[model samples]
Target: RTSIPINSVDQAIGAIRTKIIFGGLVISVLAAVLGLFVSRRIARPIGQIRTWAESIARGQFQYRPSITASEEIEALSVSLSRMAEELRERIDTVIRQRNEIEAVLSSMVEGVVALDMEERLISMNQAACRMLGIRMSDMQGRSIQELVRSTMLHQFVNDTLSSRKPTEMDIPLSSDGEVIVNCHGTLLRDAGGRQIGAVVVFNDVTRLRRLENIRREFVANVSHELKTPITAIKGFVETLRDGAVKNPKDADRFLTIIDKHVARLEAIVEDLLRLSRIEQGAEQGEIERIDSRISEILRTAVQVCHVRADAKQIGIEISCPEETRAWVDPPLLEQAMVNLLDNAINYSEEGKKVRIRVTQEEGGMVISVHDQGCGIEKKHLSRLFERFYRVDKARSRQLGGTGLGLAIAKHIVQAHAGRLTVESIPGRGSIFSIHLPTNPPRNGSASHGDPLQPS
Candidate 1:
């Protein structure tokens, strides 16, 4: 029975071949899956490297591509990693340099504004905004023409942008003030010398201009001061020689006029010296505890001008709260108050009343001098505090004014970290105000007033 069960060789061969074919199909399917996994693995590493390289070119230092391959791709991955590291280092260095330049520009007292070739403001520091009376947030990225109001500055910027050269312009920033800015510009180029854009740097010289104007005014004022007395002396001598002596009364009158002129001239010289001393001392006026003797100062100023007020039939009124007080150098405050009061007296017409009021306003105290006199025109109001500026030059001389009161007052206010402003309308009246902080700045900070308030 075992012999008869034996199969043919051909049947065995066919069974073996079928098993081999099935085995081959299984191996082929497994190979396809393995190949897909391997390709995905390789492609993922390349993609990660590509992403990192893109980030590096864009100046990002955080991209760190991993290296896991062990073939030709591995070597390429190593090189890419090295390149990314070097790129990060260079980018960090550039950032540090940029920050240093920004710090220097921000610390300057004068303004600095930089613009790109597109005529848009690239950047500006805090001092620049302050000097221009603009907010930093609003000034950045704006067109140069939109930001700068002065035609001189606009034209100068256009010329500099086009010419790519350094320029200087005396830009009148305000009716009361002018700024001298030294502008420098150049085209920004890439390493290949291809023009990318332009850059402009604006350096403010407003304070320098103000100082120069002061010096000019001083010279002219001194000359006029000297000439007034000399002219009076000549007039008196002529009157004495031209038979005025025949009438002792007229001769006495001429002599009295000459004496008055001499006193005025002497007073002018004395004021000039006082102002010089004050300005020199201004830088050294170390922050100190100031008295709040607002009432006492007001009383003294009013008392000194009382006789004059009575002569002009003008009454001096004091309206202030008992708690009114301010941080102030008493001497400086008293002097400034005297100047304000004297100005009211000089400007007020005869029989018109003047009022002096003091009270707390917000974080500060305000002292307002109100006069019902020939009010100043709007155009002259801004320069009212300027040295030697006069609304009526003839009337100022007649009133024995040295034309230095308002200037002295302005300096005193500045030294005290306060603001002085005037509001007037012709044929109506005027109000001159001095606002000072209520608290004396501690630790002797030069910024004695509140930072929220700009003087």
Candidate 2:
């Protein structure tokens, strides 16, 4: 109020105008600076956020946003980085799990096949490739009928596809080979019970089925063998009581027949017991390294059956190389050799020759017995080693054979970790070979000497 002077109108007007201009310019400059700072803070953060989202989409969540001095922006950047890292880790875990599952499915031993309702192969493992003899890629979208050559398997797969039920079947490969496949398939469904696809699992049971067949044969043979001896004993006893008991001479004749029957029973019992022992892990304590002198064992067997061989006029011949040897139990091998010789003498024609040969084979020794006998038919060979199985029931009974000799030999050979094989013709000569391991038992009563090498 003291500075406003009324003395000069021009000075007062100029002062008021200058002060008004200065105030407006100062306000304008301040507003411009404020707008620039606000736009930078908003636009810069949004750009960084957009780039981070793109990085996550592209599977690279490695980028971290720089924090600004603005508290809100810094907090937002920290949260965004945490979310991106979590997403990356989740995606990585999923990839790793998928790889592990794929590896397991590819390496499975069974033939794996998945299908849609259309009977086409959706997915299959590597083993399925080998089993079906087709490439995995080739089978992926192909119809089952086109891939499966076997009619039975083709039909089974079709049935499963139509019915959405599981099936199992046996498939034969050749005249001498077969496999049992237990297939289980289920209709895949979503939570709403809508049909999606099917998964099939295959389990192999070939060995188990073979063992069951062997067991059945054993039971049948045992029944037939026991029936013969029991029938004979009953007949002879009744005859003796009716006539032979009154006359001493007649009684003596009957007694001789009875003694043969008793011997047959004793032989059967002994063979059964021996088989039991062999099956119980071979009593590792009783194993021994025995003589491999094939000539000696064969000669001894011939001597034991000399009377029987002479009665039939069967000529026994030995052809063993001096260097041939085997690792065996002395008593067991001698008995096996004796059984073969006895069979030869009993079944051969008059004046026909029987041959015994010892030779070397891979990993073991081979002792063979050949006979010009009434040879076994092809069908009977499969059950020759079964207990009490016989090629000719009447002849075996007449000869007082218990029909367990071959079975006993087979068990003993298996107990020693060896193999037994036979080749025969219906009317020609038959050859029986016993393959003995050259190596002795690791834990047995007798110490292993240098095992005899086949020459």
Tens-place lDDT digits, model 2, residues 280-348:
647555656564566676778889988998888888888887666566776677877888788778888
Full-model lDDT for every candidate: 0.77, 0.77
RMSD of each: 8.2, 6.9
- Please report, as a residue range, the 10-residue window in candidate 1 with the lowest summed lDDT: 446-455
- Residue ranges of candidate 1 with Cα displaced over 4 Å: 1-181, 187-198, 206-211, 231-255, 286-296, 320-332, 413-416, 436-455
Instruction: Encode model 1's per-residue lDDT on 1-455: one tens digit a residue.
Output: 45543467678888999999999999999999999999988988888878877887787757676668758888888888787787778878998999999999888765666666777877777876765667777866688678667777677767776774556555666665654665556666679977655655556766777788878986887787788789879988887998998898998898898888778878888888878776766677663435455777788888888888888998988898655656777777788888988888887889988888887788888899999878888889867877788889898887888888988988888777788998987877888899888776654743333223222
For model 2 the TM-score comes to 0.72
Candidate 2 global lDDT: 0.77
Residue 292 miss distance in model 1 (angstroms): 6.6
Best by TM-score: 2
TM-score for each candidate, following the candidate numbering: 0.64, 0.72
